[model samples]
Target: MPRRTLPTAEDQAARFVRQREADRKATAEDYVELIADLLREEGEARAVDLARRMGVSQATVTATVGRLQRDGLVETKPYRGLFLTAAGTALAAEAKARHDLVVRFLIAVGLDAGTAEQDAEGIEHHASDKALTAFARFLSERGDTT
Candidate 1:
């Protein structure tokens, strides 16, 4: 194999930015899952309230709600609460199940909910379906999640 040159700091930063963009795209896929979990846990919620619960600004919640609405995953009305469509609830339930599996795995290895939820949030967005399914199977085999 031929030798390769070491990239300069600037070149490395550019590459890092590109990689970050790719990760953001993957992360955006989690919005649907996030909405599902929030609605499942809280039922109908105002955008402002959800923003408060999720530790985000109302603007951010509004934008995400708009996208979810456009996708038919949620319904929002002026001065009214947000309700998850049936499809949204189903999707969220799946995401929550996967999240529970991951959280259990993390706790099995000795972690807390705050940490587990944080780590699970990052993993849930990017981990493959097959990998999560295998993890769920592992949990079931251990008689934890069934």
Candidate 2:
């Protein structure tokens, strides 16, 4: 798909650039979902655990946790691992849904497990709900097999 050129506004080039930059940044839901899944899988995980899983540093996980906490998606303690709040659990479920769909889409297109996992991570974050729902339906029609 061709990248859409962002619409320019008269005297709003700065705002446009800022919005573009923001768009380039990772979404809060993405972070929430990742952390939420990790928490689900391991029951609880320290920031270091997630950072390592993501191949980022602990500080990045820490900052993201702070944001998630502010959004009421997580709860953390100084000496313990992080756990998803109820809201976090819901968002995590959505994230997992997106990830699962992307993984299936990649595999359906003949990608290997490793490559599909990597591709799914990015595509899961970028795709719209409509696109994902369509992809889900496509996979369902095809039996959703590997």
Candidate 3:
């Protein structure tokens, strides 16, 4: 058997760049998804509530929300509550779909529901679209519609 070749420096650098980009987007995706959930479940989304659910400080939520507003992903209506822009809503849907797919794939591979959910939180952010498609195909091949 021949020895396997290691990745080139350029390939490694590209991989690292991809990971860094994913890491940066992960927080934004998580926030938008959570806001969407809160809005659907509680009819509103507040920075305090986000902080509590995310285990972060209100100040952190405030800062992040401010950035999101500047990015045109969210809006605030004074006394009302946090609301997602059209772009944000689309993003939240995509994130949720990715997360669900990851969880299902994990479960189909033998992980428990609890562990799959916890692991999917991070895996969904890092998984590429191609990988997600492959997972979906695998599930479909196995007749897993659940």
lDDT of 1 by residue, 4-105 (tens): 999999999987886676476443345556655556676656776667766888899878778778777788766667777887777667767767788887
Q: How do the predictions measure up, each by TM-score? A: 0.68, 0.74, 0.95
- Write model 3 residue lDDT over 74-99, tens digit each, in one string: 99999998999999999999999999
Which candidate tops TM-score?
Answer: 3
Please give, for residues 1-146, the per-residue lDDT of candidate 2 as tens digits. Answer: 99977556754797566556545434666666767666667777778877887788888877878887887888987788887788877877877777888998888879998999988877776676788888878888899744
TM-score result, candidate 2: 0.74
Off by over 4 Å in 2: 1-27
The Cα local distance difference test for each model comes to: 0.71, 0.76, 0.96
Output the TM-score of candidate 1.
Answer: 0.68
Candidate 3 lands at a TM-score of 0.95
Write down the worst ten-residue block by lDDT for model 3: 64-73
Clashing pairs in 1: none
